[model samples]
Target chain A: MAEFKKADSMLEWFDQRLGVVNFVKVMMTEYWIPKNINFLWAMGVLLTVLFTFLVVSGIFLLMYYKPDVNMAFDSVNYTIMQEVAYGWLFRHIHAVGASVVFLVIYIHMFTGIYYGSYKKGREMIWVSGMLLFMLFSAEGFSGYMLPWGQMSYWAAYVITEIFGGIPVIGDELVVWIRGNFYVSDSTLTRFFMLHVLLIPLAIIGAIVFHFYALRFPHVNNEEGEFFDFDEEAKKYLAGNKKESKVVPFWPVFLSKDFFVLGFFMLFFFYLVFFHYNFAMDPVNFDKADGLKTPAHIYPEWYFLWSYEVLRGFFFEIAGVSGKDLGLMAFGFANAIFLVLPWLDRSPMVKPANQRPYFKYWFWFLMADLIVLTVYGKLPPTGANAWVGFASSMTFLALFIALPFITKAEAKKVGGK
Target chain B: MKEFKILAVIAALVGITYYGIEPYAHHIMHPEVAPADFSFKTLKNVDTTLAGNAENGKVLVEANCIACHAIDKAGYPAIMPNADAAASYGVVPPDLSSSGRIYDKNYLANFIFDPVSAMHLEGKYTPESGKQFPMPAYNWMSPQEIMDIVAYLQSVTPKVTEGKETNKATFEAACGRCHDMKYAGIQATTPKDNLKAYMGATPPDLSQYIKSRGEHYLHSFVNDPQVLLHGTSMPRVGLTEKAQEEVIAYMEEIGDSKKAERESLGIWVMLYTFVFAILAYLWKRKIWSEVH
Candidate 1:
């Protein structure tokens, strides 16, 4: 085994016994990272830190939370907020952390696309990330239900009701997901298990695989330059090179990541302490009532884009329900993002800044997302529905037409 | 110098965050004050020197209220069914079993003296024009007699054993005649048109009143409806101090049983969080020092 010097006597002893020093050096300290990567690159590290906060704070909240349907709201509003020590802080951190996590993940995903991080050898890492995101969505949806507030109950009902639109086993699946005919005690219990235990374990497993896949590839850079680490290392060992653009992850990337993490923490703590209920629906403070539905039932802002897609269709087409088709469209809107790497068939693996057309299309997609988010909160009326349908169609069109557009743009530019 | 800068920035941020959150935290810690219009002096001019007799008040309530209201779980057949009352008075009279838990003494006494004047209903509609509310002025009753009746109404506790009977009497006597009790399975038997004609709008269900309106607001409103709402038809029941206490108790018992527990535990929870936050900050600094 190759040996690396350990500075501390205690660490050296542990390294000899368990190879701890080598593992840390290889995975972190000695790891090569692109020097030019900007703050966007720090998102992955920030996300990991945020996840840790969520899991730790979540465990504390779980200590006081009762998942029973009748007791869920009281347990959160009364017992957790009022009975347990620092329960309000933990509960707020966990709840608000979920939103911040999504915010960070969205930026992280966008950064990956902007830098073509998902191309070639990084496909597996990207796919794993997508899988992690799906798990996150599931975890978030289930956690939202644990509060059992008016919005929680209705959101669960509306989202799960979409499954009932499927042909054949649709009705059964909805019933199965809910554990009954409605969002009841059984649903709350199962969702509690998913939110606190099952989904988190799955997320951790996915993250492990994600990092394992990420380790082999040199991290993507803003210049979209691919550095072959083996070749670079061979040259250095042979004395053909004294220095390289590739920098050690420890002092360079880690410092940047920590600085960004500190800034994020400052903002995160601000939200947790001050504006904890920012963007939170006021109606959710009321306890769940199955019979008394609020006039406007909307999902959390994060889920609004897909929710708007679901609302775009109101009329039945041919023999099928438009809503069922809308459900399919919503599923497709999310599922299409997973296959984005394949859809963009551009030969050049370059940053979006270098690809004008791709940049334009990416901005279009972002605009579509923002519009959908805004429209999702509005009542699905005549003009809004038409606008939603048009934008949703454009959203799909941009993705489907990506390969052709990229090919044509590449031909015109006369470059790979 | 770099370390100092970083530390100073963090300290500044911490200070800002603390200052930013102080006002909201203070608001949460303190009791909320109602708007000036909703506020009223409680039992100010009433002679509290005369102690109320619950037993005597009960007799007076039986004589005065039973004609229009029912205050028992056995569902005493009302003398005027909701429909007849609605037809005669425009709005059906409310039940009174839980009134003791809902109203304070001074407002109740003032209301009993002159229902129309107390409710500020004199200019809104007139009896000569057949647009007046049904509740008659009880100004003829002495302050002591009114206090006794208030004491009797307040003494009637809702039967919680059946769960549904928890607010049955107070609700029937004060609010049930017009408003529906969805949770308790009681429906208003008043004709829809009569309610519309009399009250301008059909009364909303009151099962969730205490949860929605809160105790302090209810006290002021029940004492004098017009003080909080300029033209509400709900007349003052003229309750005294003891009666008011009992009524407020019932409302609290039914609506917010966990309130005291919630409030008492909150300060300790905040304290624990403050300590935990300090520990978390130290741990975070320790871990991040590896990279720095």
Candidate 2:
């Protein structure tokens, strides 16, 4: 009877530790994420954090911000000068952080493209990412005018004027977007709403779908193979195939991600604490005087290439004068980037495994980017000026040629 | 499996919510969030005529002048890089309190019309014995308007005394802590970045700031100046446009006095490139981590 009582106490002790045992069992059995995921895998996690930062900061800015031209400039200055402590810091970090985010996103997308991450059933993942990119691009362009500085006003003026080149209803479309004869208070307000509210809400919804689709299959690599399970062992024991090498979702991968996040935080903090000065250009500080023209009024750095591309096609291609044609070409170039995923139809998953024609086209695209950037920096004069103009046309040709070239390369390599 | 699915959902929700708070806190700290309401309507009401119209412009002259120019001596207050009489008289405001004794209506109008032409258009000052320096012209106004100003100046009798000089000294002594080394009444055209690059700590001159900027911008600036101009270490000076136009006229009356130091664009380009390259490298590193 004493021995029986001892056994009962042992059972109680075992019961006390059931929660820990069950947790381990569930993790071992159900979770199939790979243990060998490399740094490339970190991008997915980093992107999640980045998207969150943009949304949260953007919403707060929208709270006090006015979209009207009369109020927009003052509103931004007010936000910086008198709003709240660290409000300026938040804005600067978010503004600069956005540029950083895109810089990271573009590289991540390219890396995914090069490594064959979108193959077979993984097409949805790429498509979702593309949708997210388009949403982000729209969001960036729309929010740019929120500051309502001379740059924002003129940039919107220059960019929106591009729709006038689209033939037939182009003029009407431009007017519709402007909400008046010009890009006025109404247009700014609408853009503010779209940027701060609509686009972000859509992006968040799409992110969930993107992650859901991403979960169905682990990422593919250059080899293009899947884990195979033994048929006999599966027939009696279980039907599931050899899945991803099992591991805990925390501590291992999470620790490495934390390290990368720490590094970025350090850089971001340094910029905020030491260099907290606003990007209000001297020309912008003069109160959007329509009469006085600033000697130079370039777009923010991120949009320089597109601006240069538009300027390239200004006179020669469309016979249009002034900044109109340049603006059109900029719009067209970016539109092509939005639709890139559907354009490339090479059967091989990896960039390295692509046909020679596709490979050559890719390098040409890279060269076009370099040319556009160089052209953006030059003064609009002399032989070098014309060369800058020519660079945009070259980039336009390369952009248009990409779809046809990829199709041809696929035909030569494999019909699919 | 169902319980584990529930757990994952809960975990993701909590993680995302916590992460979202970081940037939310970051955006609340901007400096320009609130602005004082400044109206153009209110500024038009301040009557600039000194001492209720009976003093006949003498009070206006006394209230405004006596800061820098002296009547007896040909010039006043000689400083380095501007030690000569030409520098003092040509650049500084002229003593118009005794104008009744020398010049006529036509002379004053012509002086107002083309002050540079009236004084031979020589620059801020001339070292030559009889060459004499010219004042900047106010071409925006008509001849009749210039005559009215001349008549107003001639009507005033000079009230030279110990008390007036002491009052002027007190005003300057108080304001001089900030305004002593101002741009000799000229409008500042220096870019903020270029200004920082050149003069290590000298504040910009606003001597002719009003005439150049005009009514609309000047009104906006005076309402809450720093909002329009970022990081203005200078405090606001209390003056209505009507009250300060003569001072503005006087500053323009002595134009082209100083030349700003120029900056090298090459150095700017180098700095921009270095920053761009560093940003690109960091982004590439982020991408590389995702690739492997």
Candidate 3:
């Protein structure tokens, strides 16, 4: 009660009793962030806000969406679009929000990579973030099924069929995932549960851990130097008038975060209200049909790089099934990203501009990813497959050769 | 102040861009109407009250339809060779087995009165092109006689061996003459190029028609093709109400069989998410307010 001596109002009285005021001050208001980071830093906060929007809008859609094969198409087209009040708005937001969320996350990830944010003590943060990315993929795939459109049905079939390429229990595994001999009622029901409940809960848990890991490391800056928060606090306590390199989370970073969020929202709301089908496929308007597969079957754009890698390796290696190997290659592509911290043996954790060789390699990887994404969208035939193969090889080589390449570059440049 | 101004400009640009392009994008995404020249009213006003016995309908189908159509599941060895039929009429007549299930009875009766008018192909083709009007007008037949034929077709349901039934037999009997079934792994007996030359447009494979058009649209279109899209070579395959329902059921079985289960579980999912969202909102507000 003595702590309440400075309490000035009724709200302060409740804060004194709850101690939530202290918790907030410690976690947010008093927290120090580097002032040198750019707008890329805002993507993490934007992703969180977008994820919230997705979940809320998704809930509204789930209210009217039918996951059954027969009614699923009609429910979305007739019931949601034509019947429910403002259902079109929610549906468009959820659909388009998915692509925008992935765009933000990709930028956030590239920002981490470009600045070596995954180095040293922040490995756990990187791991948690990668896990969240994996969960996001799972969430996206499962949500794609809820529509039960032509694309949804065929994509599920093709992806599940990939499991059947395994050697011993492949057929059984496919059946296990599908919950039946084919992608049917049981499959749709199971995927619905996973999309709406299971994967989202997992994403929330992963996000909490990601933030927790992030808290210890603070944030990586352009200089790649450790920030001392205690020294900054001491300066503030002593009534120093000089400008500090470290800024408070509130007002400083908060204003910038809000500004960026508002800008992003303007664009997002435009897409939702005006160009809602910007990234959607027209063929998906039709209902699911197992007997008739669409000419081209592909996952969302975020997954295209890995999907292209899988398609590139569509040939038998020795006696192993090419399909199985392709699936393995795809999984390995994603797994490599999770272990990037250990893969690079360089002692210095400088920004890309300071590390010339590292910068070139990073840009090469980005180019490779872009090539794969484009190739994945095109028909996998003749020259396209060969190009995809070359890009896939380059992608693997970049990760595998990173340590040696960086080590050699360090020796040539003389140690920093 | 600089940051504020930049943000204000960005906001203004977004608003301007949104308002400027919104109407055009809307027009593209959802066109105001179907193309002008391809318009025809649905047979919503056609009378469908006439009822006919399946047994009598069977006799009528044997007397009139058997010459051009195979009414049974075993559709091969049709009375006229498909090539000769295609050469003579510009489009080979479809089999009649599944017509009852895939069309509306009212549309079936109206289409029977004038085949060329029902399909809007009165002068779309000429004899010099070897693409004359395909189906002969059967307006002389009474509405009850057509209804009987439809009833008979409806009675010939595909045998369901298990929970699922294949539409192979139904599709082959009805759509095999003009359209190929190659996508579904069934080979076409007629030469595709000749059929295409005769019909003008290659009849699309019907294997995925159920998935594409849906049951409601399929019913209307199948009853009278011209009503949905003008100047198509597809003749109205006049079928009874019961027959159309059966065909739609067959299509559904082959296509979206799990639709019922998918729709039924949506409500619970919505309720759960709603409760979770409210709790999440409260938690976010509480946590976020600490910084404020």
TM-score of chain A of each: 0.94, 0.76, 0.94
For candidate 3, the iRMS in Å is 10.9
Tens-place lDDT per residue, model 2, A10-110, is: 64556455555566544433333444444555666777777777767766676667777777765655554235454554565567667656655765676
lDDT of candidate 1 over A128-159, digit per residue (tens): 99999999999989999987888899999999
Residue-level lDDT of model 3, residues B12-111, one tens digit each, is 6334433322344334333443332211345433345788778998787777777777655634346777777766655566766556655555555556
Worst-scoring 10-residue span by lDDT in model 2 chain B = B254-263
A13 in model 1: Cα distance from truth in Å?
3.0
User: Which tens-of-lDDT digit does each residue in B201-269 have in candidate 1?
Assistant: 767654445655556667776655666666666555554444444545555554444456544555554
DockQ of each: 0.06, 0.03, 0.04
lDDT of 3 by residue, A1-416 (tens): 35347778877877878877888877786777776666667788899999999999999998999888778876886577546776766787788899778877877898788788998888998999999999998888888887788888888888788788777999999999999999999999999999999999999999999988978777888678776767865664464514455656765566667656765776676666555543455557656777667766777767778888888886777997767668788878979999988886775678776786888898798778877876776677888888988998898889889998888767867866
- Span of ten consecutive residues with least summed lDDT in model 3 chain A: A236-245
For candidate 1, give the lDDT: 0.71
For candidate 3 chain B, which ten residues in a row score worst on lDDT?
Answer: B31-40
Model 1 TM-score relative to the real fold: 0.66
Q: After superposition, how far is residue B62 of candidate 2 from its true place, in Å?
A: 13
**lDDT for each candidate structure:** 0.71, 0.52, 0.70
Query: Which residue ranges in model 1 land beyond 4 Å of their true spot?
Result: A1-9, A231-243, B1-134, B137-292
Chain A only: give the TM-score of model 2: 0.76
Grade the docking of candidate 2: incorrect
